[model samples]
Target: MTIHPPDRRDFARSVPVRLWDESFAADPLRHYQALRNQGPVGWGELAPGVPAYVVTDRRAALDVLHDEETFSHDPRAWEATVPDDSPVLGMMRWRPNALFADGAAHVRYRTTLIDVFDLVEPHDLRGRVHRAVRLLVGRIGPRGEADLVGDFAEPLMALVFNDLFGLPESQGDRLHSGVGKMMEGGDRATVGEAEYAQYVLDLIAAKTERRGDDLPSRLLDHPAGLTREEVTWQVFLTLGAGYGPTANLLSNTLSRILGNPLYYSTLTDGARPVMDAVVEVLHHETPLANYGIYYVRRPVAFHGVWLREAVPVVVSYGALGILAEREATERRHPNDASHLSWGAGAHACPVKQHTLLLVTEAIERLTQWLPDLDPVVPRDRLTWRPGPFHRSLTALPVRFSPRSPASEPSGVRS
Candidate 1:
């Protein structure tokens, strides 16, 4: 898959596409198409003055994701170049966790995470999700009209993840608000990042004094012998990583399911599984749309473009979704899980099963309780949150038949 290098004149005349603009947030596909028009690798600005080479072509993206030696995950070089107050710094700055590590360090951090999460059985995780969903549904079920993003998906994730990480359920709002603002990368990003950091620091401090049967305590006691600071960063990465994308997945899946009447009917009647709708969203409108960030140590020619040293080379997962749809054939089923939404190679997402279980169970429980739920606005008309990295909705308004908490099933009420 070789692409001819653009001539110097074309490169000189090209302008970097701005990804943080409201226009891109509203209709990212249009911006993605424009980026693709530039070449396999195109120039993009994540924020003002932060330029990166966005990989829009599928093959080129795969090459970057797979070749870890050529492209590093550590962002210290790039971090040094960016401003301390850059909104993107909250996400792009180097951390001791696996997301920003490489080689032995990456393996060690990743092993600890996998081991701790593996301790949680599927049934136990499902029960946690069910309980959280029931509580959220109980709150909103009586209201009849609810914004699924705020009232359901976002809070549900906070409740479940907070419980898993040993934080009191009361802190769920802090978790949601902090992570949401931090991922959005804007005026409030610094405040959001500080709130989230304090939340994690408090959790680690509490767990250190009195350990519990939770992810944080387990990481603290692991044989790998991680330090307090190391454990804090791991918990920070896991909680933040789990919350934002999973919430978006839940909301995005719900939006797709409710937007199509036939699909909703099929889903309720058991003709089509909820996983199909989830996969469709993963293929076409994945959450965490454009966050696969990498950097090279030196200038290198990759798939025709000369990548500058230390500049970010982001895999445009949203753009890859577009190419996947265009090249999709009958042989590839709609439920195919070949999408790069979970990413690829060494840095691929490790908690996919837990995420899938939580989302699917949450949807099942909500739909079962409020079977007559309807969307207040069309999917296309729904507004998205503005940020370069995430494809999230600002709100997902839905309406349903109002029901009393006392009328719900025995275990549903809070």
Candidate 2:
């Protein structure tokens, strides 16, 4: 028998105005309690009759994101609702990359690139992300107020991705742009799937010509290696998956610190001070809020619901259903950390360590370069950018003093 909760819209209607509204763009975790009050499986939809559990329970979320046999991460669960040629389709399809593959195939693609994600070691990138953060900080340092989103977050992503993947200097910017475009919306309109496809095809050809020890070239040489099209597909995956989430993560942390004074002292007072804060922010407000699906694939019961296949199950980033334990108050400590920002199970972010290392590096550098780092644009006046898959802040204005020596590029932004 299928179990479901009461109507969330109706229940949420009784919630305080500010609390309800905040549930939309910003942290919806506060509503998690209320949603859970109704039952595990709640009635509501990003679409109609889309019965889903407004999961606020830590254990439940792990059970769902971690279990693939009952639930699918293919992103194809919504084939019935979304259009066939949607950019999200780029995500659902077993395109030019490996994430779309499952079981053994998924294992192969992940194993091939495991080294890239593994070797990143945040300490390794400290100097690199530090240099980028320092340079961007300098740009807005004189201003005394600037958006952390652009000045700090975006640039950090470029530097981290570039350094980790070891992309060539000349092509790095374009790759970044292409990925950003895809993240903002559909790959069809943004990546111009066919056009970007050709472009990536050409890019692989050129990179293959040199065949150096760089990331792409190295992947090409790996056994059970992929073709150029396959290579480009994976490139698409990196950009689509990694880019905006990191940007959003940085911006969200700043927003939290700015709004909640408790965060500043509480989060930063640790051996690895910045690490706890970053994880907390990511835990509280996942950049990728929910993983979309059209069907359950099998008769699987989650959070008390026996969801049938083809039912659009929105598996959120575990923010709603998951819990952040009190012990996580300590840095590098997850004993109390029940947060599920990264999806779980076989589909859990294979690049988990790499992404955190990048985030940790950015935070550490921010602390070092701008100990007094604070946003310039008045907090309430700031506007945030919106994306369906990733929650993003369009701009974050801030200012800092005690600048560093890193130089900024011409026409640079803070």
Which is the leading candidate under lDDT? 1
Off by over 4 Å in 2: 1-23, 26-38, 43-56, 75-81, 85-87, 90-93, 119-123, 168-177, 184-202, 258-272, 292-295, 299-303, 321-335, 377-383, 402-414
Leading candidate by TM-score: 1
User: For residues 242-344, could you state the per-residue lDDT of candidate 2 as single tens digits?
Assistant: 7668777777777767565566655445344555566666666667765533245666555555555554455555345244542234564552345566656
Compose the digit string of candidate 1's lDDT tens values, residues 27-130.
89889888888778888989988888999988888888888778899999898898899999998899899999999999999999999999999989988988
Off by over 4 Å in 1: 1-13, 409-414
**lDDT score of residue 334 within candidate 1:** 67
Candidate lDDT (C-alpha), each = 0.87, 0.56
The alpha-carbon lDDT assigned to residue 93 of candidate 2 equals 48
**lDDT, candidate 1, residue 279?**
85
Estimate candidate 1's alpha-carbon lDDT, on a 0 to 1 scale.
Answer: 0.87
TM-scores, all candidates, are 0.95, 0.75
| C-alpha-based local distance difference test score of model 2 | 0.56
Q: What lDDT score is found at residue 244 in candidate 1?
A: 90
